[model samples]
Target chain A: MDSHSHPAPTADVATVAARWSKKAVVVAGVGAVLAVVGGLSAAKDGGFGKQFGFSYLQAFMFFLSLCLGGLFLTVVHHLFDAAWSVPVRRLNEHLACLAPVMFVLFIPILILAKQIYPWMQIADPASDAALHAKSPLFTPGGWYGVSILLFVLWTFVSFQLRRNSLNQDKDGAAIHTQNMRVHAAYGIFIFALGLTFAAILWMKGLEHQWFSTMYGVYYFAGSVWTTLATLYVISLALKKAGPLALVMQRNQFHDIAKLFYAFTVFYAYIHFSQYFIIWNGGMPEETFYYVQREQGSWWGIGMLIVFGHFLIPFLAFARIDAKLNIAVAIPVCVWAWMMHYCDMSFNVMPILRPKGFELTITDLGCWLFIGGVVAIAWLRSLASHPVYPLKDPRLGEALGIHFHDEGDAGHAPAKASK
Target chain B: MADSNIDYTVKLGLLAEYATPAELMQAAEKFREAGYRRWDVYSPFPIHGMDDAMGLGNSKVGWFTFCCGASGYTLGMIMIWWMNAHDYAIGVGGKPLFSPIFSFPVAYECTILLGAFGSLGGMFILNKLPRHYNPLFKVERFSRATHDGFFLFVETSDPKYSDIETRKLLESTGTRQIEEVRD
Candidate 1:
């Protein structure tokens, strides 16, 4: 029988679902406790609480970027008809589900908007003249509602498409493909709008007077970078679980790694462009952002990302042979995750401590809390479906077991299995 | 050699068909082990490691990318230098004439553009693409190659080829339904 015509392997859906559900409940419980404890601790210690508020806002922004990145990946994969991503595409889709969870997480930002954002307090006539001068350009209520609405719309659309895809797999419906394509096209438009408002709300609004057109693209580049990294780590974990093992292979891993590498370069380009432009322009307002970031304790973190995010990883994964090696790939993935956290800190912390101080426990706690919440939400989504789309038309082709090689001695090619 | 060519054209001998992917791959490996070099396998999709099985070398696209990327970088530097430093000399932002930082974005774009073009051109030159026709398409059964068939062609032009000997080698390697081409 030809590869495409072969029946899918039978698997116990109930068993997979139960395992993931249990894991999700455990993670959610832990995240809830941590968030409560972290929140209470911040309130008790006024100095530390202020830092906690900022870190909590940063974590929300980071997770927001991660989910948005997944959304972009899903769109790009469908646009290009990429077959290699089929194995990991489900994981990315599930991660995209975190957008709603992040929307809820953003509640803390709204509560602390006055403390975290200078724009929110501009109504006080006694506030600093410089802050009042920037108030005309900044509107907190408008930004908050817009940001939340955009997230809701993006989540609703993404979930719809993801649902259709899963349903298509079970019933072998071809129309769903067409439905998804149409949805994705519209989804891309919403994504662009949502992403712009998100950048304005989360990052730009931090310093309300500060403005940069490149900020939107900068945020996007970072989002995609972290998303690709998250997808790689999750795919590796899934392969280790042994259910989707047959679908995952070295070639697939290599492709994802290449994408990660490409986006790191893209991120660096956007970052340098923003920095050089502002420095050359010499606008005091514009230069203030960089001056704060380029000096003090944060400068080292910035330099580390410049190298760790792009240079080090670029050199390490330049060769095809290295991209194919899991041992090498794993470190690059881990480093990417670290670089993302550093990048987020660079974007947020400057507003809080313009002079740049040492790392604090609040920063670490907030990241852990956000990480736990995101992990739990993502695991819950995975519990609802097969890890790999078993009935996907491209799965066989992705597995490299198509019709042409039938009856050949190379049927189970060594490389194919890898 | 001329006599063998005539024999091959007249009829294919010891023809048998494979019904499974595993069998076809096994036959391919057998051919590899037997040190056969003048054969080609046609598949509906790209199979991993099939190149090694067929003894193909690494692709030359990388060399193309490197050369084109270097040229692109050089061109970007020269273009910006001529436009800003030499031609107009209009300084708006008090920036230096030869700003590597300013030139970086343009240089990066050029690198990607040239690299992409180089890969495309190299692929075209290497694969001899855009040809309207090929002699291989003349074979009736070969059409299935783009669909469901995996085929190995032991060309008559190869130095080691003889009608009788090649047929024996193919049969021994478990290649089913071997065919001959007339050029």
Candidate 2:
């Protein structure tokens, strides 16, 4: 091994804040305006409450995944004590921080629960056997309680993990790393369970009569799939802007790109498995979901998802080098994000417009609202501290891995230390 | 012995063994820096930076896997569609012959199957592997390539190579042992 060591660089907080604050203000401002416009427009549509319910849900699922999936990645990062991920881990933490924001967003859904779930307004629960059977869990009170508990659990766990990561930036203590490991091991268990239930609560409950055990996994697939897309987009943007240029290596981006490829395959697996199982069984209740999807523009979008989300990406990222190849990765990531939007749209929109595809102004507005607002919030959190985890012991190992290409190896030579 | 009357196994090259990864890496660097092309490095376990030291890019097998996977998926889809939709038209579960939905499992499975095939195919092609014997096998110390030995072997065919000079270079680079490997 050759001797080469340098102190990890930290971003100037004031500088980051100054650069991002103006953009943040504009994004959040536009988001708030569009959301309000979307909400107001929904009031004029026939069954205004119902229209808003699904439109809001579409936007809700899209952004909630940014948080949920980011949290999942963050906890697992800690659980593994992954040295390679340390440079990019803080950004993942920022995304995970959106869990609290999602909770705030979830409140509106709760207030509109009756409109969102027609069953919440059921007149004679005694007459409906299936309704009666699920009454204990589906009661307005029980459902709301579960929602609260789930978000609370998510917020607490994610907050702690991020807090630990940030704290290590100050002390570089072994204790923070050791503690996060324990938290993450359990955090993953909670994430899997809570996300499954959250999937059921948020999207699956739309048609109360229909259910699939695989429904939760389907959402899990899209959640993480979309999350990876979002991660790729944000990290690449940051790198290009030079905020993360110094701290992040080609390997970090490459590793996350590899993850994006993996989830592409995994998303297809779950997607295919769920559809095949439901189609194979041909049960009325189960088949109804696919039946609705097989019609109108929904069918076309579903096929787009199959090819766009799965096949195209699977082929695009076939090589480990694809990870480092920003040209290939950026386009593929953009496509993947588009596919994820379609995935979320396909999941929620088909429910509201069973007969055909319907595009409402509110849907567009809500999307802008969520996209801009969430991006603003994430950027704020990003600027609050050093972009990289400067104090973590693995920071050295992470920055130490070198690339063969000398073209962009502007940093000091990262001798392979292992 | 006269060159034509030499023992049947032609001289392969010099095989040098390093006691540690550092020594092997330094030697690899020296060899590459000195513009030696017909050469290779091997260790019982993978060593980081070895690829850079040898001036190698990523393996080409990834493209093989992609092509194989794509072909597998396309072929699998056609097979399922032909069997269910066109040739046989079996309507199981009232699913259309080419539901695309139902055929995905088959297509997905094929993608994985052929992708694996591609990986194996790529491995064999890139490594020029599966041949059982090497002249290096005749060197007892070279047996450690699969266990503890870290080796740098420059073929006699290399333009810069000479038995005496190569051995001297190996010795100076901290290799514990060097031996002539014969075919």
For lDDT, the strongest prediction is 2
Using TM-score, give the best candidate's number. 2
Give the CA lDDT, 0 to 100, for residue A366 in model 1: 64
The lDDT of each candidate is 0.73, 0.78
Instruction: Please list the residue runs of candidate 1 whose C-alpha ends up more than 4 Å from where it truly belongs after superposition.
Output: A1-49, A79-82, A124-137, A404-415, B1-28, B35-49, B52-60, B63-92, B109-167, B173-183
Interface RMSD of each: 3.7, 8.2
* Candidate 2 deviant stretches above 4 angstroms: A1-14, A400-418, B1-11, B74-107, B159-182
Relative to the true structure, candidate 1 has a C-alpha RMSD (angstroms) of 6.1
Over the stretch A184-214, how does candidate 1's per-residue lDDT look in tens digits?
8888888887888788777787877677888
Model 2: DockQ vs. true structure = 0.33
- What does candidate 2's lDDT look like per residue over A1-418, in tens digits? 1113334334554365557667766766676676667667667654666777678888888888889888888888887878878878888888888888888878778888888886787888777665787777777777999999998999888889988888887788899999899889899988999998888877877777787778887888888878887777777767767766655666677778878778888888888888888778888878888888989989999889888889798877877777667788888877877787788888887867776666677776667667766777777787777787777887756775433343324222343211
Q: What local lDDT does model 1 show for residue A21? A: 59
TM-score of 1: 0.77
